[model samples]
Target: MPITEKEVRKIAQLARISIDDKDICSYEDQLNKILAFVDEMKAVETEGIIPLAHPSEETQKLRSDKVSEKNQRESYQSVAPTTENGLYLVPQVIE
Candidate 1:
């Protein structure tokens, strides 16, 4: 599960990242540590554990679905340069 400088360089090429040649050893060490941590996590036991979407069991609270704002479409559209059939009109940009 250890990462090497060659592997790091290959990963950088695939990810389109520019890693400095001097930082290759640093990146290789960091990646190896991450891989070792993943290997440690793979050793965990979860036979009877149920996957959960959230940490808490309580459901989220919701607000009332009733309308709270008055309709002002006509008032707002009045200032438009051109509008037709309750819809705004725009000039053609492409042939």
Candidate 2:
């Protein structure tokens, strides 16, 4: 099903985004294309196909979880604009 302007607006609201008037039509078109692709996939009959983790059989690298260095808190905080109680202080926005 093609997504309409109202549906786009609803999706924007649900995603907590402010979609501008100029971008609403583009968003609707993109959403419709995505839905159409999904509909096309629904028409395929894959009864016994198994899902694979990766396309190739290459192995991934594993890393050790041990800490290699201590926290450079004092050194890093020395360059900050402001600091208090071992924390970087930033300007407050709200009253």
* Whole-structure CA lDDT of model 1: 0.89
Worst 10 residues of 1 by lDDT: 37-46
Measured over all alpha carbons after superposition, the RMSD of each candidate to the real structure, in angstroms, is 9.8, 5.3
What local lDDT score does residue 59 receive in model 1, on the 0 to 100 scale?
82
> Which has the greatest TM-score?
2
- For model 1, the superposed segments whose C-alpha errors exceed 4 Å read 45-95
Q: Assess every candidate by TM-score.
A: 0.45, 0.47
lDDT of 1 at 69: 87
What is the per-residue lDDT of model 1 for residues 15-82, given as tens digits with 9 covering 90 to 100? Answer: 99999999999889888888887787668898899878789878899989999889999999999999
